[model samples]
Target: MTIKPFQVQNMLRHYGQHLDQGRRMARYRMLLQRASPEDVVNLSQDGRRKQLVEKIAAEIMDSLMVSGSSNPVVLEIKEELEREFGFGMEFRYLPLEPELQILRKEGEELTEVVGEEKQTILQRFWRITLAKVNETML
Candidate 1:
């Protein structure tokens, strides 16, 4: 089946939202770390902080399986999702738009440092595309 563009956009929005939530949770953890010893002890003792971190981590992981830029994991998930859903998928990783290049240089540099694994990149992109498609259809 063919996936639609709007579906992909929706999935991307969801993925971005979850990722932001995960980042916020991480920031909370950092803030807690910087809190006074008594505050840290109280928060740690409550167990909710630990639970929140775990929950957020799980959400991030789930979102990542569908949206992660990592080559291998994305490929694997794509393959699984496509098999389950029966659709052709594709993804394009164009460089950041020229206007945003300067702001995104560090991320671009990191992706470069990580290097592209061609087979894996293609596989993951396809899988992510499939996921976007599937999510949209639902």
Candidate 2:
């Protein structure tokens, strides 16, 4: 799960030269729409799935820094997320975080509204829970 500010900082710091700021942002939005919100990862137990997701997040940020955009790499990572830990994968459009909420110069709110009100909680950031390996399966 994303810890909001830290991840956003990574994106800004790791902006790519290839995708251009607009395209990179577009892709980022797209991915987030397809991901789940995770504020903290539980690593005391099975942590492999969380590690995999974190790896993908880091690589995508790194790729943007190095390769501008790597759609193939992103897609491959998505596939792996589903293939290995299908049980916990989730996707949905999420509301903007408090940090993203802003009053525009035009006296309008920058936060996107859904239906009539903004979503109160964002549970849409991508995260994973590694399943315990059962002896029977082993």
Candidate 3:
């Protein structure tokens, strides 16, 4: 994703240190104000401050993710989100299925018998995955 230089700088101003250190107390105050009314007895305490702040951070990060913005600046913001509030995206690879593995092996053997370039199942899968990653990076 492409992002303007000024936009990146603006994001940097709001994320990282600004998120964890400066705006923390300000957000807490806002939360307190929104949670309780002037006429009602105020029950806001320091005990719930951490939880409230974390909830706010989670909501912000959720909005950012749902927006589908994946610029490098957004990645840097995600890093800060993870570091400061324990909220960010996670990528994981599940194991291949046994049936798929068998099919791949059979395909490799058939290609070898047909005088095509010989490659093990693992090697072919690696090449396919590498090509896909490179294609997406562009």
lDDT of each: 0.47, 0.39, 0.40
lDDT of 3 by residue, 5-122 (tens): 9999878645643334334456568878887565555446643554454454443333333243575443554454345433233321113211111111232342111123213432
Q: What are the RMSD figures for all models against the true structure?
A: 17.6, 16.0, 19.9
TM-score of 2: 0.22
Q: Once superposed on the true structure, which residue ranges of model 3 sit more than 4 Å away at CA? A: 1-44, 69-75, 80-138
lDDT of 2 by residue, 43-108 (tens): 653466556655565444333323423465444543454465332222212233212221112234
Q: How close is every model to the real structure, measured as TM-score?
A: 0.29, 0.22, 0.21
Candidate 2: lDDT over CA atoms?
0.39
Candidate maximizing lDDT:
1
Clashing pairs in 2: 1-38, 36-124, 36-125, 36-126, 37-124, 37-125
Instruction: List residue ranges in candidate 1 displaced over 4 A.
Output: 37-138
